[model samples]
Target chain A: MLLEIKNLQASVEGKQILHGINLTINEGEIHAIMGPNGSGKSTLSQVLAGRDTYEVNAGEVNFLGKDLLDMEPEERACAGLFMAFQYPVEIPGVNSTYFLKAAYNEMRKSRGLPEVDAMDFLTLVKEKMKIMELDQSLLNRAVNQGFSGGEKKKNEIFQMAVLEPKLAILDETDSGLDIDALKNVSEGVNKLKSKENGFLLITHYQRLLDYIVPDFVHVLYKGKIVRSGTKELALELEERGYDWIIQEASEKSVVA
Target chain B: MMSTTLPTESKEMHPYTERFNQLEASEWALDPSWLNQLRRAGIAHFAEKGIPSIREEEYRFTNLKPIENQTFDFCCGAPVADPGVSQVQGFCFDQLDAYRVVLVNGQFSKDLSDLSGLPEGCIVESLNEAVRNREDLVQGRLGTQVKVDQSSLAALNTAFFGDGLFIHVKKNLILEKPIQIIQLTANGDEGSNPVASHPRLLAIAESGASFSLVERCVGDRDTAYWVNSVSEFFVAPNASVEHLKVQEESLQAYHTAAIQAYLEQDARFTSHSMAVGAGISRNDIHSILDGKNSEAVLNGLYLGQKNQLVDHHTLMDHKQPNCNSHEYYHGILTDDSRGVFNGKIYVHQIAQKTDAIQNSRNLVLSDRATVNSKPQLEIFADDVRCTHGATIGQLDEDSVFYLRARGINEARARRMLIHAFASDVVDRIPYQAVKDYLENILADRFDPKD
Candidate 1:
């Protein structure tokens, strides 16, 4: 298993957001988590990424046969756990190329490999920029500063391409993208997917899944996964709103 | 303003006053008749004002006890065999084809300076030479801009200033390259007593002339010295001047400098000052828009760590109508350091249609670090627009996590954000060499081990 979360329970500021979340993923598998607003979709992603604000009350997250919760955010990233933020930060004065090179060199240093030279690194960045259809001028500008919503999302995927990870979790990557941007982002993700890597895509709408099909889809309601099914489950949920699943979960809780 | 009489008793006299009285009779006081008169007037003014104490409103946040308690011998005619020219060559703008003036230990080094291809009718020489040759220019504008009665330090500097740069750009002449003035201070001997140097600079740009000036101050890191510098600029009508001042003295040094500019009608002036060194430093800048439709912009950035204390005080006086002024200053404090910023914009009653804005931003990187920011605007004109604001904050947690999730360590992420905060002021600089030099210094400071 690439990632295994058993009975995950987390909270923020003393309010429990994730009561219990249990999920599993294997190599080369693309798992889509579809949920309505305030269904703990983002909470799950933040908890897995080791965000300090969210406290993991009780649960064990194992990644590649090691405890994922025991490592820092950067350590988790170096250990092949990458997370794409919903709203990418705008860091002024930090050039895009410089930041990426530093991150890439750090990862290489951790893996006991020699550092990449500036010329080689530039070539690699240029090649990856083509995959995301990013402007070459963006390399000279500050990181995400003055970039449009669609460009910001594309930049996230571009970063994922640069730093190849074993398990990647993208939280609401399709929130603010246009149709063309959505297609471009989906295409970038599809090209990076391989048998050696896995993806856990947390999104709200089913439109994104149409471009990049998922092997399995799960319905998250009120901090718990109410039901799990195959790819068809996403289409069913898209056609009929999430009221039915939410109503069923409450009724089941009363009966129990 | 309150006026207090000076004590007559010798014991009650300020230490600096006593030092000035003794130094006034020395042979170094020999100069032209007008220069001697200027020095005498400076000493008399300093004697009455003495050293400014925290009791005064202008010196409320800064204490001069450290400077008041100790006595620093003046360095005069000190022969420096080698002023570490090669070491400073790396810090200079050698890539740019420009005339260079190098001053070591408050004395000009003609051998190290390169003034070969200066423009015709332009004067680039030492202040001592200017006092002898161009007496009319030196006597007309040397002590007119700064008020010696208000600042005791300025008075002291006027009385004891030995040698500095004298730059004059003739009327209707535009220079192709910027002029770079580099000042390097070092102890006369290893492990010697503390020394001090007061360098005075006077730059004049005639009407219809344009030029750029870059002044840098650097010192030996291991020495304990005091550098009290005063600079005055005279911008004639319709002339434009861009000034860049970078102060990177020793960590154990005491630096108190002031720059005052007088702008005539339709003149344009912009200054960028960056302070990154000294244990305790204060920079005072005052710009007076005495001409109609003149514009002035002041930008500054200061970075402090450990026990360093950095203070910046600026004043923009709109004395004429249809003038505009903008000021932006930022500071980053870490460890137990403290930062202070106080900016004021004053518009007179006759100065109608004046537009002015002042903003100060500070980022505190440690729990113990502190910053005090105050932006004041006083407008007596009914048809003026004046706004001022200040903000003190820490690095945005969201920004930090964003970088961390991208595989950057905590320390590096914090440094990147701090650099971003400082770059806002640095980006306004037009000179490529100055920009590159500041960026490298910021990088080295953030990642010291590297």
Candidate 2:
């Protein structure tokens, strides 16, 4: 198994968000967590990325047989964890090419490998940029500064292609992208997927699931997984919408 | 308002008062009668008000007691201690295609300066030579642009200054190559007594003249020498001047310099002042947009660490209609250092349609490091577009986390952000060599062994 969360609970500013969320994913498995807005989908991604704003209250998250909550964001990243932010941060005066090269070399250094020189790194980054269909000029401009919503999402996927993380968690990567950008992003993800790695897609709609079929689709509500099934479950929910799932979960809680 | 009034206890004898008496009696080179009267007026003002005290409104944040308590030996046309040609290159005046002028201890060095192939009617000589030879050009323009009683330091410079740069571009002439002046101070040979140098530079560009000039103030460490220099520029109608000033004085030195320009109709001037050295340095970079359709751009980048204190005061005076001014100053303070920026955009009543933008951004690294930034906009005209803001903040943690999420470590991420914060001002420079030189310094400072 690549990752296992046993009764994980978290909160921010004295308000609980993710309450006892238990999940597991084996190697080469793609897990999709679909939910309504403010249903703690992004919170789970942020908490997994080691954002300290959410206080992890209890339980354990074991990634690659090591405690994930004990690691810093950089340590988790060096251990092959990457999270594509829903809203990419704009770092002015820092060019995209330099930022990606630095990140690429940093990952290499963490694995006890020699850092790639400028000539080699440029070749790798250009290849990755082509996979995402991002313009070559974007590499020279400031990172995510003055970038459109679609461009920001594409840049995040492009970075994931360069870093080649073990377990990639993409949060709302398809929220603002058009159909063309959505297909391009999905294709990039498909090209990077391997038997040795896993994927966790945190999104609201099942439209993204139609492009990249998930082995197991889980519906998260009130900070807990209310339903889990195969790709057919996603088709059923897309046709029926999330109202039925929320009603079923509430009635079951009332009966209990 | 800038207060020119002396404090109540002004009758006390001051160091400059006694030093002026000694220097005036000594034999020195004389210029025209106007310059003589100007010097006398300057000495008279200096004798009355020796040094600005901390009690004053302007000097409240800056204390000049360390500079005022002791007397600095004003080398009256004395030969300065000479250094080898290699020593000159050590100050980072390396390979650049330009006309070179060198001054040691504020005294002009003819052998060190090269002015060959200068265009006809273009006078690029030392002020010591220009005052006597081209008196017609140097007489009225020298003390006319910058007042003699602007400050006590200016007064002292006017009273005791020896030699400086004097450049005059002919009408409608455009020079492709820049004129670089490197002022080197290595006068520590005068033991016990700290030597002082008051160098004055005067540049006048006739109508439609265009040129680029670079000024560097460099010196060795471990000296308490003072550099009280004044630079005045006069840009006539339809002329343009680009000026770059780099101050890298010793850590134990006191550097007080000013660069004031007068812009005329359709004239344009830009000044980029980068201060990375000096124990206690203060600079006054003021520009008067005096004519219609004139423009001025003043930008600065200052990095200070340890106990160093760097202060800058600027004024963008829009005097006529349709003038424009743009300014950006960013400072990065580390350790227990302090930074101060007081920029004023003064628009006169008749200066209609003035478009001015000023922004001062500072990054104080340590809790002990502080910055006093204020943008004072005094607008009298109703039809003007003036946008002014000042920001003093530390490195953003969100930016750091974003980089760290990409697998970069905490230290390296912070370094990248700090470099980004500092480079925004330096990157705006138009010269590649200057930008590279400055970026290299910032890289070595923030990220060593990279």
Candidate 3:
């Protein structure tokens, strides 16, 4: 298994967000997690990325056969865990090329690889820019500063393409993208997908899954995964909506 | 407004009065009569005003009681051996191709200076030499630009200054290489009292002339020394001058400096003041737009760590019509250090169409670090545009997380953000070598420990 979480319970600021959650992902598999607003979808992604604010009350997260909960956020990235944020931050006065090069070189250094010089780094970044259809000028400008919403999302995918993590957790990457941007972003993700890596896509709508198909789907309701099924489960949720799942979870709790 | 009060009888004038009375006419190489007269006037002014107090509005944040209470021995002669020019090779902008002037213990060293191949009609000589040979040039512009009565420190420097430089850029001439002045303070033999030096510099850029000047102050090690320096610039019509002052004195030193410039019609002045040293330091810069269509740009950056205290005071006066002025200063403090930035822009009643902007931003890294920033603008003309603002803040947690999420460690991420914040002022520098040197220094000083 690329990632395994057993009985994960986490809270932020005195409020519990994830309660008794269990999930597993194998290599080359893409799992789509569909949920309504505030159903702990984004929280799960954040917890797996090792955000400090979210306190893990009781949980076990193993990545590549090692304990992932004990490591720092940067260590997790170096160990091949990538997270595409819902709202990418704007870092003024730091150019995109410099930031990306530093990130890539740091990861390489952690893995005992020879660092790439400025010339070679520039050439490599240019080749990756074509995949995201990003303008070459963006590399010279400040990181994500004054970028359109669609452009910011595209930049996130562009960064993921360059980093190439083993397990990628994308949090609501399709929230604000237009139709064309959605198609382009999906195509970029599809190109980077391979049999050696796994993906866990947390999204609210089923529109993103239509472009990049998922092998399995899960319904998350009230801080826990209520049900699990195949790809058809996403379509069912899209058509009938999340009221049924939420109602079923409430009734089950009442009966208990 | 000039007060004729004799400071000899004042209670605050005792220490300085005794020191002034001990000076002899034969001690200096300049014209004895004129020099004595100027020194007497300066001492009287200093005694009348005494030291600046925190109760005063202009000096509310900076307290100079420590310097005022301690009696420092004046370094009349070279007491320490010349450590040679190679001693300062590790300092900033040392490798740049320029006319180099070296000063050790407030005395000019000809062996360490390289003044060959200087352009014709340009003069780069010691102030002592200029005072003896070119008396007319030094007499008219020496103590005319700055008001000694307003600043007791400047008055004190004028009274007891031992040595410095005199630079003259002739009409319509442009210097291909920049002029660099390096000041090194060496400690006295094993166990002695703290020494003090007062160095004065004067530079005149004639009409249509242009040049760049870099002045650096560095010490061998952490020593208890006091340096009170002052520089005056006289820029003629259509002249352009870029002046950069880098102060990296010893951590145990007390440094205070002032730069006063007067601009003629259509003249331009740009200055960058970077202070990253001393236990306590203060830099005061005053620029006067005395003629029409002149411009001035002032940029400053200061970094303090441990118990260091850095203070900066600046004034931009728009006295004529159709002039522009802009000032930006940034400070970063860590540990128990404190920083102060006070900048003001004044527009005269006849100075219509004046454009002025002043901004002061500070970043405090530790809970104990503190910063006091005040930006003021007084505009008398109705057609002028003026704005001033100040901001004191800390590093953003979100920005730090953004870098850490990209695989950079927490320490490196914090360093990068701080560098980015400080780079805004450094990026405005037009000299490549100076910019690169400053960036390297910033990295070495602020880099995270392993």
- On DockQ, the leading prediction is 2
Give the count of colliding residue pairs in each prediction. 0, 0, 0
Deviation of model 3 at B379, angstroms: 2.5
Worst 10 residues of 3 chain A by lDDT: A129-138
lDDT of 1 by residue, B228-255 (tens): 8888999999988888889888888888
In order, what fnat does every candidate score?
A: 0.83, 0.79, 0.60
lDDT of 3 by residue, A187-255 (tens): 999998999999999999999999989998998887899999988999999899999988998999999
Worst 10 residues of 3 chain B by lDDT: B1-10
TM-score of 3: 0.93
Per-residue lDDT of candidate 2, residues A109-168 (tens digit): 889999999999988887887677888888899999999998999899899999988999
Model 3 spans with C-alpha error above 4 angstroms? B1-13, B28-35, B76-81, B88-94
DockQ (Cα-based) per candidate? 0.74, 0.81, 0.70
Q: Quality of candidate 1's docking, in CAPRI categories?
A: medium
TM-score for the A-chain in each candidate structure: 0.98, 0.97, 0.98
Higher-scoring candidate on DockQ, 1 or 3: 1
DockQ value of candidate 2: 0.81
Q: After superposition, how far is residue B38 of candidate 2 from its true place, in Å?
A: 0.7
Instruction: In angstroms, give how far residue B218 of model 3 lies from its true place.
Output: 1.7
TM-score per model over all chains: 0.91, 0.94, 0.93
